[model samples]
Target chain A: MTHTQQQNEHLWQLMFEKVAGVISTKDLHYLEAQLREDESMQEAFHAIQISFGHEDLERLKEDEDWIDILSVIKTRPRTTHQHRFGKYTVAAVLAGLLVSSAGLYFLTNRKTTPPLAAVTAGESPQAVVLQLADSKTVLLSDKTTNIRLGDVQLHNAADQLTFSSPDNFSVYGGQHTLIVPVAKSYRVTLSDGTAVWLNADTRLQFPFSFNGSSREITLLSGEAFIEVAPDAGQPFIVHTPNSTVQVLGTAFNINAYNPKQVRLSLVSGSVKMNTHGAAVVVKPGMEAVYTPPEGLYTQSFDEKTVLSWKAGKHFFDKASLSDICLILYRHMGIKAVIDSSLRRHDIHFNGMVDKHKPIQEFMDDVKNMTGVDYYFDAQGILHFR
Target chain B: MKRKVEQHNDKQLLRRLRTGDPNALNDAYRQYRVWLLVVATTYLTDEAEAKTLVEDFFIECWDKNLFKDVRVPLRTFLFKTLTERCKKQGIQINMYP
Candidate 1:
């Protein structure tokens, strides 16, 4: 460790000592300033912060030392957070840290890794921050945040949750899950009012705030139905799994979740969809298809088959059975598997598959059309051959 | 919007277990083994033993008609009881009340 490294460790020990008490704005500011002096220090501070994201600061709040010493620090909710990051703590301070889901910690008392020197934005990046219910914090972008795999919301940068309708929220700074629970979906209405309907199993990210003259968000592989809120001031942009859609307030759908292709369907307004640096500006009712050779290229498409899910309808215009399954899996978490024997069907399907019909009914119809048998287990394991 | 699916409303199954049905014991445990492990995870330090102990707790619950009170929610009661039992068994609950 370097001199700065020793200083960083000393800084952390000081914070830990004060953590047993209420840290004042002055205390926090002092620490933050010490960190802001060097990128290494900021990374060091965050590493420590992430480590104790799961601490029961509530117990710390009740500690005589904490209660007796400070202002803006004596509030504890009924429950803050359980296990966040790798550590689990349960307590509250003026700005107490919180964690959502928890599991056993296998590396307790382990030596800490060297602090990250610098955290950089992606060349093609997707970023977000959560505004948690409590004023505490978390990094949603860390792959480690996928601690418990299930439908769970993680709030990163708030003290209280005040979202009823779509509000401007951040996907935490790290790997986060944008979970849309069953029976209800979330319409992420950005500050620009570009409504992105996040399906049940989807996760995406936008920076805490837009950058430069363009509004941008990156899709790190998940399905989202985006209606770019038009702003003459700043052109809205969505960077998907493969393609990038630039629009000036247009109603469009883009599915880049698949590796080989990006399907952009325009409902109204105009959009410039591109793949592999190529571009196609599309009018209303048209779709741009982009496929890069390394799975990155762009083309134009007649978008007669978009807006199916938005209108609560499944619009299939001569789509293949495999294509149909991909659509269903994206919008709904249903897995459809056809037996190898059924691969020869090479069948094209049309008409709408609405949410009303039990998935079994649709699978039955599919089986009849392709002469393939489909069975779903209680665990939702669907097998079709 | 929707609650966790861990909530199960299989009343007769619970009643059967409460009434000392041995076959029901094996069946229900098999069905809820995963969920119990998840619950025990919050309490037990040893991930491996947490799973095993949670399974054993279910076996005990099944044999004892732990779900005898239908009016009271079975899961809530079971979890509260599990917390008490685990604590007694030296399962350290870092900060649970």
Candidate 2:
């Protein structure tokens, strides 16, 4: 390379390093001087900064189809992801970026990445299904499933469904529910960018996009950990049969599988839980248990134990036998019965349940560890004696 | 024939984008935003942060004209930019390495 080319490369490298937040102030002048004289240097510097955020950039870059994702969605306009600005404004900004000869070259010269192909039969698990507003049942059996509803798009990949939008489709708004069957869990990204990790037997109802002041969803049943997208103008609300939770923005978990006692655990941010017209606000690291007649109460909970399902594992500090059996039944479709002989065992045990393993294996491991002998009855009921 | 057609389409889109057409950029964003978020989340673990970072990257892409003389694909360029940025931030991408 020539001397000028070498100098420019060194300058680009320095500016790129600065994007990663590594350069000192002294190095700033050299970068600034180059950037001011050469517009491409500035563009390159900014591009590098935005692309390399931390470790995640590498994984995204390696994905060949990452660029064509928008192209695929263009075929179906309504399904949109997070769009803070309207299409025109977004385009104007992007146009400004592309106007730079350097930026234009960067965008066009590269090979066009292929769009994600539809999930074939063998690529996905067959258990989950999507019940659309039109009552059209779409089976999600592949590793990734993409469905288009008018202008709205739904992409389900690896147990997660992300709702996104197409450019021409202005406001793709509607209501939809995701039902996760027993012995399974799924994650979803709502139109507003709120992420919900739904546990087994969870039916979550949400809109295709938030049009109103409050973004509300019904947790018909089961457990979910929610990370609400921050929009002070809109409050994120979750409704259950017995309780309703309201928060501006935050990450929290709600276990409302039981109609009687609805558990709301906040990991960060604050949530206002209302049960039977009685309200209580829960702070970070705190939990609120709402029972209709008894009202809502607050207490500290083990974060690891409460959030362990995200890792496909369940942990208990001193969990009771009945409670554990109920949990197992709920998660593994196991019919666990405690024989009258062992009813009073009151087996309070500490253990971990690996959801990936077969229910029988977990049962045997627990039985041996607790010395609580168990056998399958004539009816296939697991009886603990 | 299909490859040539796609190449023609890509070139057309790039030409429009170079003339400061917002639709082209918007189209690109719509297509790749989620994938970018997915990649961001793998490292940040926080959806909000990942989204914000990706958005910032897009804006920068607009303002800096980082796409000049693009030899690599746009997606590859963005990925390359993201990795280099992360490296400077002292983030280790590969756990095994």
Candidate 3:
């Protein structure tokens, strides 16, 4: 109200901006001193403090992410919603303008905001962490499934998908195999902040947390696209019995089913592919194959064929009918025994299986194409005699 | 007696709040408000805008008593709750209004 009181308040505003606001001992002292000197100042400070004491603030503070967030808000200007009272509102609103624009410009484009290159090609999705109820955990791959071991609902947005639970402070996925039968689809985030989009007949086992230096998940069977979260402190590694794929920040896919060797495809960023001492860095658009005895992964352009499942199509450039049958067995939930007489035959076929059709439709197509009569006996087994 | 929210943490606070304990509510507010404002400001930049945003957030918390089971930590609950609020307004938080 008085000129002196108004002047002191303005001084506090300037000081608040100067600190970029962590509210250190000095700030607390200064704010207290100003309040003691003038009752009106006490009222003014109380109004400002009111924002800091909001109930929402308490709930959010219990979350670990509010630290940097608090800095931005404390220093930003006030909005018109806060100003309905008058001139004080105008200054607060104007100040809010500058702080918010600065905050937005920084956060929305922090990586690409001129000074720093976005670290990657474009705005990639953020990392997601899935926590289950019982404290047990599992990372998900685009190829693994049946993770019904926890009580949670999963949703995805960009790179970050949060798992919300009614009975948990943390969600659990213990070591479970999520078999996403081929032509079918499923999605989930592991406890360590990785997002997996699994394709048909895929299965993998993941722990709740890396718990060790390296974050690891074992791929058993199927194809999956993974957007690994970036953590410079701890590198993310995917493992099969014979190979290891290590990356810090990148997008890639793995097809390391048993009996078929292992395939790792890099979509973006970089990856180090190793097959027991034979290793190489796989750049974007390259696929690496590693198998036992052969013990080494060769690289090439099977990139398009690799990601075909992501696009909801099967890419079998010239795959053998036996291998194709294996794919069908897992995806269609059937058991097949191909005629040994036909084993040595080329077995190779080239065509796209849409997976969107029923198993009978797929069997029909396979029977028509191979010109072989197939019969399913009472035991749920298919015999080609 | 202020319950510790036996079903989870913070649920007690929300319940205490439903009965109108000014100190408990203010304590809860003090613990969360400014931080909420900051996170909200990232998406809703104007000061008047930020203040109003915080006000609405408090209003919502008061109305819903969302701290039910406290399934996630308070901060996660707050960030998620505010993020949803910002999203509903079709405006990003900690950014321009």
Best by DockQ: 3
Fnat of every candidate, listed in order: 0.00, 0.00, 0.10
Weakest lDDT window of 10 consecutive positions for candidate 2 chain A: A103-112
Best by TM-score: 2
| Candidate 1, DockQ score (0 to 1) | 0.01
Best by lDDT: 2
CAPRI band for model 2: incorrect
By lDDT, is 1 or 3 better? 3
Off by over 4 Å in 3: A1-184, A210-212, A339-344, A358-370, A373-385, B1-97
Q: Could you give candidate 3's per-residue lDDT for residues A1-385 as a string of tens digits? A: 3334334424334333222233446646765665576564444344234323445334433433222332333443432233222222111111112122111121121111321122122222222123223322223322111222234444333322344445333434344444344335566587766887776555555654555687887676566788898888888887766777898888998876563577788888889987776897887888788777777655676666777777666766566666766666544445677766664465556677666665566567666776656677888777654
Per-residue C-alpha lDDT of model 2 across residues A99-179, encoded as one tens digit per residue: 112220111101122111111211222255555554334445433434445566666678888867764565434566676
What order do you get sorting by TM-score, best first?
A: 2, 1, 3
Candidate 2 Cα misplacement greater than 4 A, ranges: A1-126, A166-173, A317-320, A339-345, A358-361, A376-381, B1-97
Docking class of 1: incorrect
* Candidate closer to the true structure by lDDT (higher is better), 2 or 3: 2
lDDT head-to-head 1 vs 2, winner: 2
Instruction: State the displacement of the C-alpha of residue A164, model 3, in Å, after optimal TM-score superposition.
Output: 5.8
